[model samples]
Target chain A: MNMVVCVKQVIDPEAPPASFKINQSDNTVVPPSGIPPVLSPFDENAIEAALQIKDAQGGKITAVSLGINLLRDVVKKPLSMGADDLILLEDEAFVNGDSLSTAYALAMAIKKIGEYDIIFCGRQAADWDAGQVGSGIAEILGLPCVTLAKKIDITNGKARIERVTADGYEVIEVSLPALITVSNEFGEPRYPTIKGIMAAKRKQPIVWKAADIESESSKLGATGRRTKLLKLFQPVREGECEIIEGESPEEAAVNLALKLREAKVI
Target chain B: MADYKGVMVYGESTDGKLAAITTELLGCGRKLADDLGQELYAVILGSDINGLAQEAIAFGADKVFTVDDPLLKDYQSDSYTPVMEKVVKEVMPEIILLGQTSLGRDLAPRLAFRLDTAVSMDCIDLSIDPESKLMLQTRSVYGGNAQATFTSESSPQIATVRAKTMSSMERDDSRKGEIITIEAGLDPSAIRTKVLEKVIEEVEGIKIEDAEVVVAGGRGIGSEEGFKQLGELAKILNGAVGASRPPCDNGWISDSSQVGLTGKIVSPNVYIAVAVSGASQHMSGCSGSKNIIAINRDPDANIFKASHYGVVGDWKKILPAFTSKVKELLDK
Candidate 1:
């Protein structure tokens, strides 16, 4: 089976966040300092899943991504993680495409690259946290898709899966050529091996553009995406906390309990 | 322009059972549905989910629209999105709602994408104009830095709501609703991704989301051993130990123990934030708490504003006393 995994580069979660002042005049986020970027946390789960399936099923894994020059690093990281090929759709024009647009680009790329049995992505990229891209791809491709998946198994040509739901969980099974966004527990992300790293150093990814992918420039970027970030400043907080006074540690503990009981937790 | 007159609710569950927010959204959905006279409809996706549809009515749904199939079972992006898109195309719902949990977070944007609509996620409050039926989704922006009102102009506008933001409806066994089963006619072959396993965190007792009392800690606990201090506080009080996004991000706490927008949006009756500075990102997740008590040496800490009660002091110095007091009260 052939598979495609989409990955994105994002600001490292550990990086210190810089505050943004809303541009009241424009109602937009005054861009903050760009922090060190890395592969989104969820994307790592996809890489892990792809590697596992490749190991078990003997299929080729294609690493697909859209970004800037940093695509080199992002593409290599997946190669190191065990993807057999890489397809990078990087350019300034592709930046800021909302889920619909992103999926459109991905679908175009998938079509350009021929057929595949499945597509994988992170549950949601840590940076955007929109969690929409994978499903958008599914919709555009008209494929079956599932998000927040913790478990996925490919046996006897069909895929069996498990995903987290609001109330509890579910066990599901489906045929492939599906798009799946992965959760952290989907599998343990693999570490780069010396051989794989060396192998990636010699490999170059195919980079596609909006024109190359045959997407109309109108539906290619801002025009294709639906939502707009009118404003991005942080929201205000409410209320002043009252410090409950207690006579001793034990007293404080008792006061705390009273607070809980008073609040109806117990 | 079309009138945004109707109220809509997204009915979803994890283990093939209805979630508390489904009831709450339904209860709230009913109120809005009643105000608009357009009717309250709950949307559910996944196969074999008909078994769980009854509870939606008990929470007050006039109708239930369900798309059931084996492909819909585990929430694949491929299978679920079209089903939702089909509903939006068929009903032209003025508004759509979902729980702000993991599933909700993943699905909401995808639905918004299919509808080619705008989305406001992690919202705490939702209000609709009685006459216009326009929905103003209220959510925390800039990491809880501010509270903002959001509106959508396109078709089937969507929003994902925080858990505990609305009260779950009381169950009424006598209630019932009309059921509409939609085939969605989704092709099984197009789905590319699949789930392989299910690993529940296996936590015991009430989840932090459902907890009535929460004992939270920040950096002031001072040591890895300090978590044991927080754990003691949690143990004596029969509550969960949570941390600000900072501590959890800093590797001082487990990711599951994280409390913030990306972590878990929770509201307990009483929330005690110890040694926490109350960053907006962390504070937004706690907006639902009935009462908040902040403890810190910084008198001007950000947490104080969002907290209902506070003690200005060292948490280490204050924690033992707080524990003893609670023990003493329980002993009494």
Candidate 2:
């Protein structure tokens, strides 16, 4: 078996909300002070999904990422977690693309790699939350796609996937050479072992530029975006909370319930 | 240029009736269509869906298109995307709206890509720009820390709206509309995916998404025993129980009970958050509640910022008293 996982680097979403800032001029996030960028949380789940398959069935996993100035430690985290190879499509030309451009680059990269039975991606990136790139890649590559998968099991030549839905889950089966976008319900990703980290540090990433994929310059990065961002801002929080007071904690609880009743909020 | 004219909604239904999001899309679509001085159209695809066309019209659509086929009975990217692609190409509507649901999340992007267009996912609000006549799409980004609005120049501008953010118009059975039928034209061999079974992890009471009241706890809730207390409070209030990511991650509750950015988005009438140190990620799910009441030991917990009423106290001491008092008042 062969597998490919797509991952991305993003500002730490767990940072205190107060630390979040946007550069109004560019509508881009200003990395919070003292907090380092981490791999987008869901992408780790995607890698875990691939790793789980590799654990059950002997297979090689290749992790692919596209971005400019990706930190070595952040991008290599997948390799540290047991991925066999790391491929980076790093170039200034790849910056600020929407789902179309981003997925196009990845699809092209996968086409160039040429030997894969399955591809996995995070349900959505923590930064944009668009949740479109996986499906875009599947459509561009003309592969069967499943989104919001919690588990994947391979049998014969097909993959049985537990797909999460609004109410619960559905068991869906698709043939090999499919794309799956993993959701967080898959479970916590494993921490890299010390020995694994050492191995990762020794591994060199294969870098691909715009020309390497043979993609048209007009359809590669920001130039390929089909949508335009109009504005980005935080909506102001308006109301001040009225605190219910009492000497005893139990008394405050009683008073809080009384307050809810009086305000007709209960 | 292709003549892209009206606003269209890709409506959904289950158990023989329209989904709530479908009506809401029609309600919103009605306005956009009227603003453009065009008709509002709805397209529903499924087996035995001829009866739903009338319901779509009652909701606000001026025309309903039905593609009745067993292949579409279960939504698969292979079957539904191509059918939608064909319908969209033929109709050439200026705008398309879909619910941000399992089907929408899977279908919208593929349909958009197949049509050589783009789509905005999980939009909370959408409107047409007066100047550009473009659909202005606004959605939460960065774990709900901020919002970004986007627009596109592509024909049939597409967006998937988050559930419950838009209002549904009153159903008027007297409303009149036209219904058109389209052949499914599906080849069974093309669909590579097969749905084996649907398992519903039925929660014992009112669903959190539909509950008027939601009683949610976070990491501060110590164990499954703590969730039992929340369940009691939810029972008393005729509501549902929810938890932040930690409790669900810790196995204190099921993942379905998790409420946050990655969890379920719930917009209820009253939200009582207990022992929750509200992270922005968690707040994204419940921030739409009409009134928020918080109880936490730390007055500085981020939950207080979003609460309409708050109490600084230990939930272990506070929750029991609070639940009993509310029960007493309600029983009277």
Candidate 3:
């Protein structure tokens, strides 16, 4: 089996909520200083989905990422987690692209890779939280697609997936050469081992620019955006939490309960 | 602008009635259509959903579109995407709305790409720009840390509205509207996937989304045993127990009890977050609560930023005392 998983490097979602900052001049996040970027959390689940398939069927997993100034350490974490190869569509032309343009670039790169049984992507990126690129790529590739999958099992050249639903879950079956978006409910992704890290350090990622993927210049980045972002701003929070007080911790708990009742909030 | 005229909403049904989210969309669509001096159209698809068209009309839709087919009984993306594509092209609506739901999340993007258009997903606010006569879609990004307003240049601009963010109009049976039936015309061969089974693991209590009061735990809750205390508090308060991602992911609580961006978005009258640090993603789910009460050991925990009331102490010590005190007061 040959599998392709799309991963993205993003600001650490686990960073302190207070540290999240955005630049108003441009609609972009101001990356927190001490925290280095990590693989988007759900994308790690996607890679784990591919890794599970590879482990069961003895196949190869190729991790694909699209961005500008791609961080080798961040993108390479997929390889360190047992993916066979890493492909980066790293170029200036790919910067600030929305779902439409980003998916188009990824579809082109996947076509260049030529052969694959399955394609995996996170349900959504942490930064933009659009949750559209996976579907867009499947549409552009004309491939059968499933989104928000919690579990996937391959049998008789078909993939049986447990798709997450509002109420519960639905088991769906689709043929091979399909695209699946992995959800966080799939379980934690495996951490990189010392041996896997050593192997990944020895392997250099294959980087592809716009020309390498043969993408349309006009359709590459911000120019290719279909939706114009009129404004990006943080919503102010009214921090007026009246901390319940007492001499002791237990007394504070009693005061809290009393306060809720007094305020008619309970 | 001449080619596209009305505003369209893709509606869904639950247990044979119009879904709450669909009604909300119709309500929202009604305002936008009235603003544009156009009509509000609603579309429903299912095996035996003809009855819902009239319900949609009563809930603020001026016209209703119905597509009845066994193939569409389950929302397979392949079938629904094309079906919607055909309907949107034929209807020629200037703006289209869908619920930010399992069906909409799976369908809107694919449908938009197929129609060579653009979509704004999970929008909290949507309106028409008076100057340009274009739809302004505002959505929470960065997991509710920031909001972005977007406008699509393409005709039939699409957006999926978040659940409960928009209100449903009061039903008026006196309202009159037209009902149009459309042909599914789906090819079984074209459907590449099958839904083999559906498993509904409902929590045995008031659902967090519907609860008046919610007691939520987080990583600080530590273990399954810890969640049991939260359950006790929820039971005493006549509410439901919820969890942030860590507790759910850690298997201390069921995944259904998770309240976050990827989980359920809930806005109860009172949200008591126990030991939750209020990450932006988790905050996106419960920030709409009328009052937020947070109890955490760390004084600087982010939960306090958005909380209305707070207690700085260990949940293990505070929760039991708080629960007892509430029980005592309610007993009187």
Candidate No. with top lDDT: 3
Name the weakest run of 10 consecutive residues (lDDT summed) in model 2 chain A: A211-220
lDDT by residue (A1-266, candidate 3, tens digit) is 99999999988988887888888898778989999988899999999999999888899899999887678899999999999999998888887878999999999999999999999999999988999999998999999999999999999999999999887899999998999999999999999999999999999999998999877888878888899999999998986999998888889999999999999987
Model 3 CA deviation exceeding 4 Å by range: none
lDDT of 2 by residue, A1-266 (tens): 89999999999988988899999999888999989999999999999999999999889999999998899999999999999999999997877899999999999999999999999999999999989999999999999999999988999989999999888899999998999999988989999999989999999999999889868888878999999998999868779999999999989989998988898887
Q: Estimate, for each residue in B1-332, the C-alpha lDDT of model 3 and write its tens digit.
A: 67999999999998899999999999899999999999999998889886899999899998998899999989999999889888988999999999999889999999999998899999999998999989999999988889999999887899999998998999999999999999998999999999999999889788788899999999999999999999999999999999999998899988889898888899999999999999999999999999999999999999999999999998888888999999999999
lDDT of each: 0.73, 0.92, 0.92
Q: Estimate each model's TM-score.
A: 0.75, 0.98, 0.99
What's the best-to-worst order under lDDT?
Answer: 3, 2, 1
Using Cα atoms, each model's DockQ against the true complex is 0.25, 0.85, 0.88
In terms of docking quality, how is candidate 1 classified? Answer: acceptable
Q: Model 2 compared with the native: what TM-score?
A: 0.98
Query: Could you give candidate 1's per-residue lDDT for residues A91-179 as a string of tens digits?
Result: 77776776677778888888887878889988776655556788778767777776677678887767777775533456667776677
Please tell me how candidate 2 rates in CAPRI terms.
high
Model 1: how far residue B15 lies from native, Å: 10
Query: Considering TM-score, where higher is better, how would the candidates rank from best to worst?
Result: 3, 2, 1
Ranking according to DockQ, highest score first: 3, 2, 1
Model 3 interface RMSD, one decimal: 0.9
List clash counts for every candidate, in order.
68, 0, 0
